[model samples]
Structure formats: structure tokens, C-alpha cells
Target: MKKIAVVAANGRVANKVITEAVSRGFDVTGFGRKENNTKAQHYVQKDLFDLTSEDLKGFDAVVDAFGAWTEETLPQHSTSLKHLCDILSGTDTRLLIVGGAGSLYVNKEHTATVMEGPDFPDAFKPLASAMGKALGELRERKDVKWTYISPAGDFQADGERTGKYLLGGEELTLNDRGESVISYADYAIAMVDEIEKGNHIQQRISVVRA
Candidate 1:
């Protein structure tokens, strides 16, 4: 069985991803601020800033479901990512980040990202902007295998797993109703699928319902 490490494993998205990965027979180690409430083989309660490469060694891949909930802690996103990259530099473990959709282009021209558009919620800009900065740093690294997975504009936790979704490039995807949306469950499916397939390498990919 493939061994995987999941950071922030108690978060909604990470919880779903952990469930999916475990269901697929993968051996998983979950790390969270508190005791992991998931069904993984092992659970480690530790701060992301405290994680050392030794703690993450031996996993086939690491899924970063880490996020900042307040403006005061937004910088942790970038800091933690850098720490992970620095420690995993020469290792074979792949890093898969659950990213924000705000960084995705709203049009094919790529002149503007969704976060800069008029429709983006002002209240969420700080969070989106922080995520954008972190993603920018990830794109510049070439030492370790990293893939950033951005969900659609409407990523929700309560939606069902329809077992269907569409993958896009840097562009934000829209459905027949012209809505960009995806359930956390389906997003987890895509994430675990990518973990197993390794189709995307050092790239930013987006997901939405077909």
C-alpha cells in the first residue's frame, strides 16, 4: 500500500481526502492541531511550523490541506509551505497542495485572475491574496515534485459526492449554468486520484463539476 501524510487532516477538505485515500487502501498518517478525528493509520497532533522532514519521511506523498482562518495567521500559509519544501527538497515524496480558486484565470487571455475581478467577494480578498502569494512561490520551486489543486469558485462542504468533475488548467471552469462550483467530496476524489496517478507534475490544476 502507498503511504501518504496529510497535514491539517481534521479540516473539512482534508477529512474528506483522508477518507477517500483510506478507502482506496492507502496507508495514511494524519497531522492536525489536535487529535485527528479521522480513520487514518496514525494521527499526530502538531503545529505545521513544528513539522520536520523526519516527521514526514517515508511517505509516498504529502497532502497539504492547510489553511489560514484569520488575517493574523495568513502568513503561516507561505511559511509552512516553504518549510515543507525546504525539508522535502531532495526526497522523492510529492507535495500536493489544496489551493484557492481565486488564483485561476477568469478568461482564456490570462490577463486577469478571478480574485481581481469585480465579482470576487471583498471580505475574502485577504485570504485569496495570501493563497495567491503562496502559490506564486510554489511555482518557482524546481527541487521537489509539487502540484497545486485549486477548486472551483463555489467549493462547499455539504454537497454530495456525485463522482463527477471536470479538470481545467489555470482557467476557472464553469458549468452549463455558467456557475463555477464543486463539492468538497468530489474535490477529494480528484485529489486522491491525482495522488495515485501522478499525472500533473509541478503544475497548477483546477477542478469543477462537469
Candidate 2:
């Protein structure tokens, strides 16, 4: 991709994504509500909901890193993506999402998701549920060329960047050590790689340390 737009670029994951994408010489623009939170080739102080396809017409891809921190705002996951789908539907611009691992299946049967596992923390259920619903809603749309990538069970914000990762389908992925983890830094590499390669279109994929 020659150009990309990152929503909520000030986020922990998104900031790293911006750095990685820029390092690869892609024209990157960031859109967020907060001004001066992060650096991008171009920064626009716009709400994610305010963005239009017209606003991102020329971008090869747009990354949705929008986060909803509170239980009350959990539905933003679905609504924001729906709004984006509405605008970008039928367009050549691809929509790439930074999703959670909660929805990932725990087995090859694909009947159970990680969020439903007993060891999952009850406190985080609402957020996970919201994200899972968003993914479900996204799946129903055939017009949007969207790719959603869920992180590993342990999505480490300050974890070390190994520059290596393993890719998986619907099931949760584990490394050789049987650990499910990935750093924001390395995940950014996978994200940018997907952007450039245009693989996994209209699919949900997982990435963890190889």
C-alpha cells in the first residue's frame, strides 16, 4: 500500500503501527480526537465518526484502532465500524481492524471462543463481548474489503519486540513454548506486512510470537 490512514493513531498499538508503517516509507496519516498525542506524516484532529469515505478516498487502506475504554461506551466498537463500513462500502480502499483475541476460538471445533473460557477474567467480559459483537457484525458485510487481526491471549503493551510472529486462523495460536503472547511492536510489523501484501482479505486472523 502506498498510503494509509490510521484511526486513533495515538493509541499504544496504533502509535507503534504508525512508526512501523512510516519506517517502511508508506505515506501515513493519523486521525484522532486528541491533538499532539502522537506524530504522523499528517495528523488530523477529527472524530472517528466524523470521517467520510471522501476524507479517505485516496488511501490504499485505513486502520481502525479506535478504542472504547468504558463499559458504557463498549458499543462504539460495533457502531464505529458500522459507520466506516457504510462510508467505505464498495470502495477499493481496504479497512483493516485492530481487534481483540477474545473472539478467537479455543479449539478446532470453533464452537467456543477464548472469551468464554473459564479462566477469562469476568471484569473484562464486557469489553471482549463488545469487540466480538463488532467482528460478528463486520462479517455480514460483503461489500467492505476488511481484514481483522486479533492479538494473542496476552497482548503485551511493553513486551519485547522479537520481530517474529506466528499466524493462525480462527483458533487461538500458541508458540513452541505453548505461550500465547505478542508485543504491540511486533504486532505492528504484522499489520504493516498485511497492508503491503494484501493477504487475509475479508478474514479474521491471529498473530502471536513465533
TM-score of each: 0.97, 0.98
lDDT by residue (1-210, candidate 2, tens digit) is 389999988899999999999999999999999984665789998999999878889999999999996977999999999999999999999999999999999888899999999999998899999999999999999999999999999999999989999998889999999999999999999999999998888999999999
List CA RMSD, all candidates: 0.9, 0.9
Give me the candidate number with maximum TM-score: 2
Consecutive 10-residue window with the lowest summed lDDT within model 1: 171-180
Candidate 2, residue 40: how far the Cα is off, in Å: 1.2
